[model samples]
Target: MSTLAPPLRTSWHLKLAVLSASLLFLIILATAFAQPAMRQNVQPYLLDLARTNPDNTVSVIVQKNSKDDASLEKEVNRLGGVVTKDLHIINAFAAELPAGQAVNLSTYPGIKWVSYDAPVQKSLLGGLICTDCVSTTLLSNDYDYSINANKVWNNANNSGAWLQGQNVGVAVVDSGVTNNLDLYSKNALLRSRLVAQVKVNTRASNAYDNFGHGTLVSGIIAGNGTLSLGGYIGVAPQANIIGVKVADDQGLASESDVVSGLQWVNDNRDKYNIKVVNLSMNSTQAQSYLVDPLDAACEILWFNKVTVVVSAGNNGADGKPAVFAPANDPFVITVGATNTYDTATPTDDTIAPFSAFGKDETGGVKPDIVAPGINLISTKPGLAVKLALDHPDHLLEANINYMRVAGTSFAAPQVTAAAALLLQSEPNLTPDQVKYRLKATALAKKAKGSWDTRASLKAYDPATMGAGYLDIYAAVTQKKITDSANQGVPVSKLLWSGDSPVNWSSVNWSSVNWSSVNWSSVNWSSVNWSSVNWSSVNWSGDYWGD
Candidate 1:
C-alpha cells in the first residue's frame, strides 16, 4: 500500500510539470503573433521615417483602446511625447515625438496604431478660364446643362420651382469661405442660408476665406446665383452652407485638422441639419483606407448619414498612384473631373486631362462619378479675384463677380450639390441610398465605337469616368433603384458596357437564366444594368491608367 501511494504522488507531480510547460509554450506563441500585429499597426511611412530620421521629432497619430482623454495624454507622456491634439471622436491623439520614440509606442499596452501625421492640400489643377468676357448672355452655364440640373428644375415634379435645395445643409471642409456677395448678399433668402461658420485653424482669426478654394467650392454647391442674377444658380441653390474652416489661408491642412473638422460636423450635424459634407482637398499620402485615420473619420460621418463627397485629385497627369486618401475610401462618394468642351452637349464631354484615377488598395474602383470641372464659373472670393487679377494668365476669364476654375476640387462640389438636391427630395434616404441612386441614375457617356480616337488614346476608363457623368434629373427621378441600405453593389456591376470587352447581353441583367436568353438579340442599351448583379464578372488586367 505504501509503495503504490508513492507512485501515485510521482505521477501527479509529473502531470503538473507537463501542464506548466504547455502553458509557457502557449504564452510564447501568443507573443510571437502579437509582435507582428504591433509592427503592422505602425504605418509603413512612419517606420521609414523612423529609420531615416531617428532623432528628429515627428508628428504621429496614436490610437488607443481607452476613450479617456487623461489616460491617452498620460500614455503619450510615458512615451516621451507631447500631445498636440486630442481627437476624442476617433479615440486617438496627435502627438509630436522623436521618430525613434514614436515607433516604440506601438509596443505599449493599449496602443492600436502609430501612424505618421500626413499632410493634405487643396486640390486645384488650373486657374479659372473665361469663356466669353465680352458677352452678357444669361444662358445657363455649361456645367448646369451638362449635369442636366436645368432639366431637373424644369421637370414636372418641380415645374420650374427651382427646387433650390430648400432646407438641405452642406458642410464645406476646406479653406475658409469669405463673405462673397453671391452667398452673403442682403437678399434675405441667400443671406439666411449661411447657417453656421466655424474656424478650425489656430492661425485663422475669422472664418473668411483668404485662399479662394473654399468659396469657389461653396459657390458650386449652394451659391444662389445672386451675383449672376439667376444666370449661374448652383446645383442646390437653396441648400444651407455650413462653413468648416479646416485649412489656413495658405490652403494647407493637416490630417489632424481635417479629422477634427469632420468630428465637429458629426457633432453639430443635427443643429444645422447638415446632410452633406464636401471634402474638396486630398491627402498627399496614399495609404490604405483600412488603416488611414482620415478614411476612418470620413467613414464615421458616412455611417452617421452624412453624405460625404471627396475629390479624386488632379494627379492623373503625374502617372503616379492617383487616388488620394479619404477619396480612396469606398464609402465616401469620390468625384472626378470631366471636361464639358465649352458646350452643354453630352457627346462632347470628355474626361478631364488631370483627373486622377486608380483602384484603392482593396481593389475598390474609385471616383464614383465625374462632373463638369473644366472652366467652371462660380463665385470667387475677393482675395482670389485679386490674386487672379495680379496674374491674368492664371485667370480663365474673371469678372467682378465670378471666376472660372477647373479641378476635381470643383468637380466634388457639383456632386455635393447633387447630393443636397437628392436629400432635399428624400431627406430620409440613408447615405448608401443616396450614393446608390446617384450611381444608378448617372448617364452613360455616348459610345464612340471601338476605333474612335478617344478610345485609342485611352483617355477614359471605368476608374476615371465611374458610373459616367452626373445626371441630376435621372438621379432625382429614378423610381426603381435597389435600396443599398443593407448591402452595397460592387463597382463591377456599374462599369460601362463599352469599357469592358465582355459581351454583357449574354450575361444576366436581372435573372440568373443566362442559358435561356437570346444573347445576340438582347438590346444592350435598353437593359437596366443597375438591376444586374455582375459579381461573377472578372475585371482582372483591366486598364486603369498609366
Candidate 2:
C-alpha cells in the first residue's frame, strides 16, 4: 500500500492554489449579488440632489401597491430611511429623506420620494450690534415726531386704481402686539384692520410681551412711528396684524403651542382674511409627521393659499451647516440672512458669519435666498420698559411706541411686509404663485466672485443665493403671472378610514369655497364625504406652524 501511494504522489501547491481560487470566486459572487439588493430598495437618485442642496431636502414619493404599504416601508427602512408620511394609493408620501444615500436609482425600488426643498424665514430682530445703534431721534429733544406723519403711506397706501379691490392682510403670528403710540399714533391699522392677540400658552392667557421680540417684528412690518435714532420704515405698514404668540415672556415657546396657535389662525383666517403669515422660529431637526407637531401644522397651512415665511437658522461656521427647520420644507418660503451695505457687482452676500450654510451629510448649497437681516430696526414690545430705562425722553405713556433690534428673525418680517404689500397689490395670487412671482421678480446681486455689476436678472440659481435679493417693487410690478396651482397629489378630495374624522376641519371648510368640477356646490353636505379625497385635505387654513 505504501509503495502504491508513493507511485501516485500529488503536489500540495496545486491543491492550495485551487482552494484559494475557489475562495476568491465565492467572495466575488457574494459581493456581486449583495450590491444590487442593497441598492434595489434604496432611493439612489435623491442622493445627488440632497448633496447639491444642503439646506434643502428631497422628499421621496413612493407608490405602494401591496397591503398596508408594509413591504414598501420595510424596504425603505432596510435602506436606512424613515417613513415621513403614509398615503393611500391615491395620496403620495412626501418624506424629507436624509442625505448620504447612494445616488444610483438602480439601488432602490418603490422609492418615489424626491422633492426640492424650501426654507422658512422668521420675524423680529436681535444681536449685540444694536446696542449702540438705537435711533438718535429720541436722544435729541428737538426730534419732531410729526415730521414724518405722512411717510407711513407708501406703495401700501397708494389710493385708488392699483390699491382699490386688491386689499390684503398679514397675520403677525408672534408675541402679542402692544398699542404703541408709534403705530396707533399714525393709524397704522387702516379701518379694515382686525387684530387677534392669541395667547402663546393657555395658562398665561395673555400674549403680553415679556421679551420685546414680537413687538419689534410687528413694527418692522407695519410700524408708523419715526425711529428714535436711525432706522427705515417697514416694508408694509398698512397690512392688518393678527398676533398669535408662540414665544412667552421668557422669550421661548414650544412647538406644540405654536401648532395650537396656528390651528387658531386656521380656524379664524376667514375673519381676518389673513393672506400672508410670518413665523420667525427655528428647530434643529425636521422630525417626521409621526413625531413632529410643527411640520404637520405647516403642511396644513402650505396646502392652503396662505403665504408662509420662515427663518433659515443661525447655527453656522463650524464647518457643518447650522440646522434650519420648518424652513427645510419644500412648500414654505425659506429666507436666509445677508450683510447690509455690501452692494458690489459681485454681490458680497456670502453666507453671514453666523448664518447657517446648507449641506447634505455630504455637503450641498442651502438657503433659498438672502435678505438684509444684519443690524435691522423694528418694534420691540418691552420698548416701553427699555425706553423708560434707557431713554426716558422717548417714552410716551400708554403709547406702545417703537424701538430697534437685529437678527434673521427681524429680517423675515421685512420680507413678510414686502410680501404683504405684494399681496395687497395683487389679491388673486395663490401662495405658490406668489412665491414664484417673488423669486422671479427678485434682483440678482453680484455673484461671490463675478465681475459684472449685475451678473444677471434671471431667476435664481441653487448655488448662489437661491433667487437673489427680494425686490417687492419688482414682484408687484412684474407683468408675468405666477401660477400657484398645486400639482401635488391632492389629498383634500380623498376619503380616509381613520379614527379621526375624514372631513376637512370646520374652519377650513367655512373659510372659502373650493373649486368644483360640476355645477353642484361642493359644500360638506352636498359632497359624498365618503368619496372625498382625504389626501388633498388641508386642515390648516394657510400657514405652517413652529
CA lDDT scores, all candidates in order? 0.65, 0.47
lDDT for 422 (candidate 2): 70
Q: Which lDDT tens digits does candidate 2 get at residues 1-546?
A: 000001112467577666665465345334423453342222222444544642233455553323244555654453345577765522234345334322222234443223222222221244212221112121111101111112223223222123211245677666566645434423233443336677856544466655555676777676544433222345554456777776555445555566667777777777878877887777654332222345445546655567788766665545465444455555567676655431211133344455555632223344555566554445556644432345443333223344334356665676676667677767777777777776665557433222223345343345435566665555666646565522342232212222232344433433333322111111223333222122211111111111
Instruction: Assess the local accuracy of residue 422 in candidate 1 as a C-alpha lDDT between 0 and 100.
Output: 86
Decoy 2 TM-score against native: 0.54
Which runs of model 2 end up more than 4 angstroms from their true locations? Answer: 1-167, 185-194, 226-231, 286-291, 342-350, 359-366, 383-402, 445-461, 485-546
Instruction: State TM-scores per candidate.
Output: 0.60, 0.54
Give the best candidate by TM-score.
1
Predicted structure 1: lDDT: 0.65
* Model 1 steric clash pairs: 128-396, 128-404, 128-405, 129-396, 129-397, 130-396, 130-397
